[model samples]
Target: MLLPTTLILLASLVQAATLTLKNSRFNITSKDATELRAEPLSVTEKLSSPLKLDRTDILRLTFQVVEKDNGNNVQPHQAFLRFYDETTDEEGIQPVRVSNTGKGKFELNMAKPPTSLPPTGSAPLRVSLLIGSFVHSPLKVELFDLHVPASHPPAQHTEEASYHPLPPLGHTFRPEQKLPPRIISASFTGLALAPWLVPLVLWGKVAPSTPRLFSPHILPFVTTLALFEGLLFWYWIDLRLGQVLLYGGILALPTVFAGKHALASIGERRLGLARK
Candidate 1:
């Protein structure tokens, strides 16, 4: 009972550890000689204390953009967050593009921190918002919140720090829940083949002959299998839409031919038996 209880408590702590931004507000826009600009607004609390980060933590950032006017006259504006080293005055990490997430909201994630840095006593990082373009009407943009998970304690110094590739952006793993190979295979099979079921059944009923549930139409079967293999290869190689469609069309031709021939063969067999 003690072991199980301890495990449950550990899991709860893992889920609850997250650091969030406390202060965020939009300031005024300015113009210098040629074009207008919006100064980067400070989002986090003052730099008196160091922000803690865990090795396996993901940085979650949220932004809100409210267009002052709804009319088409207002030109589009782009916003981005730049992370900089306060001491060195350089880019601390890769800049994240702010994307509109409907209903006057935008969000960005630092899925993986570009590189690990040496430990610092004071807040060593600062973030700023950059707006690209002149705005006649005010576009109210502000960083809503920022959150990072609290996990493995900060390392003592630069020599011992190590960072691994981050897991898929928003996924968390649990120890007790078991996922086996057979279950995974079944899931993948269901996902891949389920979409064709209704259409395949309808095709079988409307065809000239009773369709063969499993007939050895050698050529068509082999062709369809090869085409499917090619499709999978092309998809994994490039993961592009054009190539997927090209291979999908090629795969579809062989599949249709196989189905039609297989059904015809089954129909012929049934008719022969009926005459006998």
Candidate 2:
């Protein structure tokens, strides 16, 4: 009577509740701990699972089920998998309807479908497992903190067709390696002083309000350009921007250049070296 209804209600509630914030009752370890718990948003509450894209790479997801069963013994069954992203919905996330074959410890030949970087991070190309409208586990496949060279499909050429341009090899910088607050504040202090220093060093005539010569907005824009973009270009050469001193030096280049030009323009006028 009420018992059957109660079980169904309980199961549905459990299914809807989010899971990632909770303790992972089951342990999911891999040969390489490159990707840990990353799941699709829809089923993120059910399971924090990993996915296997290449036919050879293995997917190992472990979970804990309630011991008591209402009707069927809780066993792994054939569930539909949808290769989808944020815009994709429950209906749209359906798999390409190809065969998994599920042979040899569940070997899969699925390709990691295209995905956009997350709003806050680059952890994309996620994976999820659906179980009767109850998508259990979801996993986010991340190669590593260090960017690895990704392989692309071979180009098709018939001698007449134009060759397609290669994708950008932009690497992600880990946020964990950001400068500490004290260091960041000190760095800003230096960048703030750049404009005035340029005038002083070149012409030896400091502006009356040299400290506050430029508008406030200019400082942050110059500093950000100096720090992030400069560092990126510096690292594109494959230099280890991870180290503190080297990274700082690389980022400082743009700021220095800006200040230098500012000096030559204004400083020369003050020194009577050139026209204002």
Candidate 3:
């Protein structure tokens, strides 16, 4: 009889230990349907309740919960906090017993700090609240705790350090639609066929003094016409609009180059003046 009793007690202890070891939880069922609030207001990380701490530091937290539907129904609840630095995870809290406060008010304190210095950092220290009576197993109970300062005992190197990577910025992304490759292939083909089409297609040239990229008058007109026609064609054309396309596309690259050079030249002039 004594040996069987010992085995049963050992099994119960093991089950309790397993429950305490669990760090993540999300159930927030309330016994009393009242307004309950968790402090620090971040809703960041969570863990399950009835959690045991290998070690715990002193923690302090306060709650100010009023009725969500009416101002007159102001009822305060109490909770206990328990943290084991030996068990560290600050993602969130899980409630074993939510809304365990029996009366309209209550308070609680844990036995020790939940963690060592390196584990507790500056996070809201977790606490488990055992509101109302410890007896009857309190079927009507409310529980919640605030982030108190976890007293992490000091040691070597830096305590409470964490790492996370920052997301990159800007649109340097390219789709693998073969658009660029096709465009490049077409460009090379155009260049290869340029000598053959020069006299046959673009049979004229502006004066020698006129810059090729910014040929005083015609380049701007040609560039603008090319843009207008290209846009129109892209929007509505079912087949290639050769005359309008050549008119516009030829000037597109040159117009852009001229504009860039203009900006560069102006910047250089301003920089020179500033230096002087």
**TM values, all candidates:** 0.26, 0.21, 0.17
What's the lDDT for candidate 1? 0.47
Clashes of each: 0, 5, 36
In order, what lDDT does every prediction score? 0.47, 0.41, 0.41
Name the TM-score of candidate 2: 0.21
* CA error at residue 211 for candidate 2, angstroms: 99
Q: What is the lDDT of candidate 3?
A: 0.41
Candidate 1 TM-score to native: 0.26
The residue-by-residue lDDT of candidate 1 on 1-276, one tens digit each, is: 999989888766533432222123322211222222122334343333333334343333434443323312212345445554545444433333434431122232233444432223334445545444343322223332222342243445465345645566785667686666898989998999998988899888886652444446646765687778877887888768887887688678768888688667767877999999
User: Candidate 3's error at 88, in angstroms?
Assistant: 5.7
Given candidate 3, what's the lDDT at residue 273? 85
Q: Rank by lDDT, descending?
A: 1, 3, 2
lDDT of 3 by residue, 1-276 (tens): 999999988766533331011112222212342223332321133433332222222222343332222322222232333433334554223222323221222222234322322345544444443332221122221233334445454444453343445576768778666545788889998999989866765545533343444644345645665676667767476545685577557667767776576656656866998999
- Tell me the TM-score of model 3: 0.17
Select the stronger candidate by TM-score from 1 and 3: 1
